[model samples]
Target: MPQPATGPTEANTFPALCAHTHLFPGARCRLQGLSDPHAFTAAPWSIGVDLRFSDDAAAAAELRTGGPDGPVLAVPPYTTGAGTRIGERAWFVREFTWVDGEVELRIGGHA
Candidate 1:
């Protein structure tokens, strides 16, 4: 995920791209640039990724410190058998109302 410039810079917004979509909360998301296969625990878990969001503020703040402070990116949640056709790669949504300007995601699958 790329950060927006504080001064004069290029515009990076996804207005026309993600025109029609539901920006649902509590979705599963994965951050990029940090992967560790050997950092395993007793049970199978996500590697260098966060899988859930919450309405609770304290719980969300606790989870934020679990990883390094890079540009957090996520894959938008999808329903089962919804036929949403998400492609192998897609751009992460750079702005949203929730999460204090973190780069949340919108689904933009290729045809």
Candidate 2:
């Protein structure tokens, strides 16, 4: 049987984890779980990858557009920081919230 998905929570603050990847290079990872959650001792698990954002154009656009009340995302110090498309739930986590500020992607376990 398939287990339920893990929702966002104080511990699961996805944005902060992304920030880790932002601050430190190649820290964040994407997890595509197996359909059988019940088969595992714990919640089912699968493979993941340490990721870095690549949204140069979009980062600039976000800064230009600015949200309701904020300065917008600051430019990343390195090339891997900015890009037009950071992720794609169509292929990956496409529905995550927009993270404007610098953060560290804190993966569970190894933190």
Candidate 3:
């Protein structure tokens, strides 16, 4: 994981982690109601997410099935130059283990 920011605004934590891990945080990354999005200031890829369908179980199922259609939850591999957007595409639940309400995402991207 990247070092915790000295101060909130002093660091771009998401970009730093993506740079190190080459992966993004997905919808389950949320620890609260909603979080500000992230982008790579410089890197090889970017990620995007659409939470409009988060409340829709059908959408979630489609995402889990890797369907090409449905809510675009965890889109990935955006060019590094792509500008920052409202959400960050992230790892699937399979990448990490969730026990009870706790998550063990060892590769970072927790925003």
Residue pairs with backbone overlap in model 1: none
Write down the RMSD of all candidates, one decimal each.
15.5, 14.8, 15.7
Residue 52's lDDT within candidate 2 is: 33
Q: What is the Cα-based lDDT of residue 88 in candidate 3?
A: 40
lDDT of 2 by residue, 11-86 (tens): 2212222334242223342222323323322422222223334332211111111223322223323333333233
Residue 60 error for model 3, in Å? 14
TM-score of each prediction: 0.20, 0.20, 0.20
Candidate 1 lDDT over residue span 1-111, tens digit each:
222232113222111112123223333233222222122111112222332333211111111112333222333344323345432222232222222222223322221
Please list the residue runs of candidate 1 whose C-alpha ends up more than 4 Å from where it truly belongs after superposition. 1-80, 96-111
Q: How many backbone clashes does every candidate have?
A: 0, 17, 3
Off by over 4 Å in 2: 1-30, 38-79, 83-111
- Tell me which of candidates 2 and 3 scores higher on TM-score: 2
Candidate 3 residue 58 Cα shift, in angstroms, is 24
Cα miss at 24, model 3 (Å)? 10
Over 1-111, each residue of candidate 3 has an lDDT whose tens digit, in order, gives: 232233233422221112221333442332111122221111111122222223221111112223333122243333233232333453343333333332222223432
Model-by-model lDDT, in order? 0.25, 0.26, 0.26
